[model samples]
Target: MAAENKKKEKTATCYQDCCAEVFNFYLGHSGEHEAILQCVHSVLPEEFKRIGAGKSSLDVLGVGSGGGQVDVQMLTLFQSTFPGVQITSDVVEGSIKLSNNFKALVGKTANLKNVPFQWHIMPSEDYVKQVKATEHVKKFDFIHMIQMIYYVDDLASTIEFYHGLLKENGRLMIIVETANGGWDTLWKTHSKDLCTHTITEYRSSAEIKACLDKMGLKYDEHPVPNTFDITNCFNPKDKFGCDLIDYLTAKEDFYASVTSEVKEAILDLLKNKCSSQKDGKIMFDSTLSCILVHA
Candidate 1:
């Protein structure tokens, strides 16, 4: 059943462009990623901390760097922590359109003086290939995969591949929206309205650990609560939330994969969910299952 479910999920199509556009808008204004980084880093004990460790130039890899919005927080953190030195940052994103937008975002932020980032615009599948060839072994100081695992075909294989990219003692940091948690529950409840795509395929801590054991990799999983309170971004008169309200109310045909009825259901659910919350709050409780691999 798991294998069949995984196959079904792999076949599911996402409204990637629409999702990215809406997500980027929220990211640009909400300071969401900064808060997430704070929570994400908390899950990792001293081992993930770069402080007091004699490491000069850090090499960091950020996967699914959508419009490079999250990089702002990451770059700012690196600069404040390690001054007067450039951290070689590599952004792995597949879309040329998104890559262009990312470049623009970087230019606006002055390209991070202490952190120079290069875009590796390759599909995640191809990236998996590099890992298989041992070409990506231990290449990054910190490897990040945030809200990206859902799009991949194989969770265990993808996790293993990213783990392979880490050097000895390197940290593979992940910030995944717990697919079966409150956030996902809400998203699923609104499936007929707001969700453009979804898959029940997920890895609990035990499941991921078992996969790691099979591959001879040891890892520690920490559960952290990830919250998004976007109340300020909403306007009562607006359709969905605020500036990107259209995204929330995007037409059914915008995501051709899903039936028109399913799309409408999702939008209605979004409205109802928002209505139920106090102060018209649009919150996503993205409980994170932070996995730390001792690569």
Candidate 2:
């Protein structure tokens, strides 16, 4: 957020210190809401007026609402398109700070006057407890998990659990980054074995489909046009050249894997790779896959 820190991170790697780094990027990153909203629109029903017609309010649930940027965008879009729609959203997330921030942002906006929000703060395990209980099942019309399901050890069960939370015709959305980004290259070149993504099982869409089939759920998949572009991720003035080195390199093997020279080269490559070619703007060639299914 500070200019010096920004430069240290360069235009590329601003999210250095925490687990929700990229998620937070959506909150503070300029122009990202537009792209995110685009994805949301494509995934949501075209005629949401009929979503929960005749109901006093639309009840929705979000898993890993994170910084709540996605919810804000949805609220903004709904207010513009369906001005009279009342929304009651229950967000099941654990971070108290992020929840408070989401509350603060939504509370200040007049457009959200018709939207009521409730936070169900708990770990996924506890959430599972309430969800698995028959008395509290099938309570929501919509449930969404974006880039959050990967954390679950038993992903198929997690998917099924969300399915149990849905009311009839209730839709569940899953948004995840496909490994098609220069991610493979980054993983091979700069990323040490310390924190690699799940490349073994359940790595791609094919695998996801298999899991869905095993669960007897039908889904519609869409490719989102957003990517993680870290091209401007550098500051030659600093010793490590970027702030990412702080969080990314914690072990000796990790540090040993990336020397100063390799780091600089990777940064340069990221900058150039992320730069605009066809449209005169940085491009997120990164792939995103979303699924809408019976919850």
Best candidate, lDDT = 1
Q: Rate residue 148 of model 2 by lDDT.
A: 64
lDDT of 2 by residue, 1-295 (tens): 5876633432111122354454454434334455556878765745354455555556788887776878877667655655566767888776676777778888887787677777777656567887666574547777878656645556788888788777766788877655444433343444444233322222345556678998889988887665443323344345432333333222223334567776567555555653334444444444567777765
- Candidate 1 global lDDT: 0.60
Q: In model 1, how large is the Cα lDDT of residue 99?
A: 77
lDDT (Cα, tens digit) per residue for candidate 1, span 148-182: 66567677778877876676568876666554654
lDDT values, one for every candidate = 0.60, 0.59
The residue pairs that clash in candidate 2, if any, are 12-232, 12-233, 231-270, 231-271
Off by over 4 Å in 1: 1-19, 25-34, 40-52, 84-86, 114-116, 130-138, 186-238, 241-276, 279-284
RMSD of 1: 6.2
- TM-score of predicted model 2? 0.71
Runs in model 2 lying further than 4 Å from the true structure: 1-33, 45-50, 53-56, 76-86, 184-206, 227-229, 232-241, 244-284
Give all TM-scores, in the order shown: 0.67, 0.71
